[model samples]
Target chain A: MPELTARAAPPLAHHFVDMRQQTEAARLGMWLFLASEVLLFTGLFTAYSIYRYLYAGVFEEASRKGVELWAGTTNTFVLITSSLTVALAIHFARLGRGKLAAALLGVSLLLGCAFLGIKAIEYANHFHEGQLPGKFYTFAEVQGPGASMFFTLYFIMTGLHGLHVIAGMTVLAVMAVRAWREEFGPEHYAPIEIAGLYWHLVDLIWIFLYPLLYLI
Target chain B: MPNGEHQTALEPHHGAGRYVAVWVALCALTVGTLLASRLSLGPPWHLLVALAIAAAKAGLVALFFMHLWDQPGVNRLVFATSLVFVALLIGLVLLDSATRFPLANPPNERTLRFEPPSFETHVQPGEREQGEPGAIGRPPARE
Candidate 1:
């Protein structure tokens, strides 16, 4: 192990031998939580697969006719950019530039809001056209037994993802406040890094959702 | 912990430039997928191509943005296991459906077991046959 530097370490938890062990434990715990999140989305993806496989024509028609591809593409770009900013926030935090880190996080938060705004527009369009889930579906352009099922999955999957975005934005907002307070520095920025992991996961889910739902 | 040794053994700190480069790559891939969708790849090819691009984009986000590239083996294991279960769930279910008897799956619209009632043909309860036993607004027949 590398020798400890002369600077005072953060207070080690009573249960851990050193700061390194505690940090590792925290990271591992976050990964475990993220794994569970993956499984949660996995179930929904499986449902999408089954329906798409059984009603291939319906999904194709639904994607081409109902969904707004431009919106999805734009949101993908926005999220990818936001992911970069959040990653940069962590980078700046590690360099002891807390203000810069907070600035990056603030940008990320704005991008997240933009994402939600675009989604709201799309949802409004769907609502106006009556392209809703299950029995609420009324758009008549695409017709088949599985037509409603497609919209149902689309709403459920994307709705759940949007909720995650809100959660991620909340986390980023808090991290931004802390970064602004200069609580994160080279010696301790795990909170920022962990929060970044979550925001990236939200982006990761959207990456798959775009092609599956919008591109078909 | 020494400030100098603060860097974890597995997780290397990447600079801002690396993140920007990944972001650019992700954006490019997003555009690539969008353009690919316009192609008349037909049925399975379209889905395969789109999913492949999505997977690539997701991989970039996870490895670079999420720092899985330099993460410890245990964290990687946790993620990989979750992915394994995902694959199993989708794969096995697809296999079952694919191998099922033709009649087990919903019949194609053209071959539906019964004709669905259209709005024009839908009957109102008030318009049902009058005086029929047990009909709406009518009394039941005695045994």
Candidate 2:
């Protein structure tokens, strides 16, 4: 009888007493996962802080000379716009506008791709200029004790963030497909909401990364 | 399909306008931070201003975009706790490094009394006294 009832109401899990409990549990679980993700990045942020403190001059010099401020700023705008789209996607999903939600997700996906494209160009410039990390760093202009460390942290922090961007893009792609299939509606849109949370988190991390790495 | 009661509890319905407004604010903050970075504030002020702007941007994303504002307290608490730990990790590490003895830091041009190890110069074994106070890998006295 419970199995039959669970089959009748597809959105509510067997353990959940109702849709409310189910959605709340899913949201709580997602938040817990996001919290863990925050901690993961926090480690790298701590490393950045320590190095920046120890070598303030070289870090600023490297940021000013080696980093492409325009590229970083452009990516920041791209991601903020993507985050808006994803949030709008969630809003539309809850309103049972599946097609519009899917389209918005598509737009967000393109924005994410644009961010990666800009990042690639920046990476190419860095490679050509010998602004590599660690021992591979041979950029003559910023050479010093802490100069390479600046690039080292730069590559590590931004590289990890790039991976997160890829992950967020993959999740958004899946959500878009699901939404297009009308899998998400007012009765059941936890997946889209959860995915939006992840995407927003990616944007949040980059918000800090842009300033800490590229700007100052 | 008498789940009408549950429908109201699923998630709060937010208008598209609210999100658009947040987006606009985010973009404005981004531009503001970019402009702030150009100023010659120097030292920690530049970093503080940049971080403050970034925090505002992040808050908008987390609260509105991520729906933390409508979320249950547990979810908000979970995220806030993680942020607290992040502050702790960064704060403690920075405090440790900032307060360490000058010569305790790695040998760098900026480090006070930072002297290159004598071994790098390939000093002959008998060239320096065996137990000299400031010889071979010893940090010079602070001025």
Indicate the DockQ of the complex predicted as candidate 1: 0.36
Return the TM-scores of chain A for each candidate in numbered order.
0.94, 0.95
* Cα lDDT, model 2, residue A36: 95
Interface residue Cα RMSD of candidate 1 after superposition: 3.6
Question: Docking quality tier of candidate 2?
Answer: acceptable
User: Which ten-residue region of model 1 chain A has the weakest summed lDDT?
Assistant: A1-10
Clashing pairs in 2: none
TM-score of candidate 1 on Cα atoms, chains taken together: 0.86
lDDT string for model 1 (B23-118, tens) is 889988888998898987888898899999989998988888888887756888888898899899999999997888555677754336446545
Candidate 1 CAPRI level: acceptable
TM-score of 2: 0.88
Q: Each prediction's Cα RMSD? A: 9.0, 6.7
**Reference A-B contact fraction recovered by candidate 2:** 0.82
Clashes of each: 1, 0
lDDT of candidate 2 at residue A82, scale 0 to 100: 95
Candidate 1 lDDT over residue span A1-216, tens digit each:
111232245556799876567777888899899989998999999998888878888888998999998899899999999999999998877766778889999999999999999999999999999898888889989988788898999999999999999999999999999887777666567788899989999998999999999997
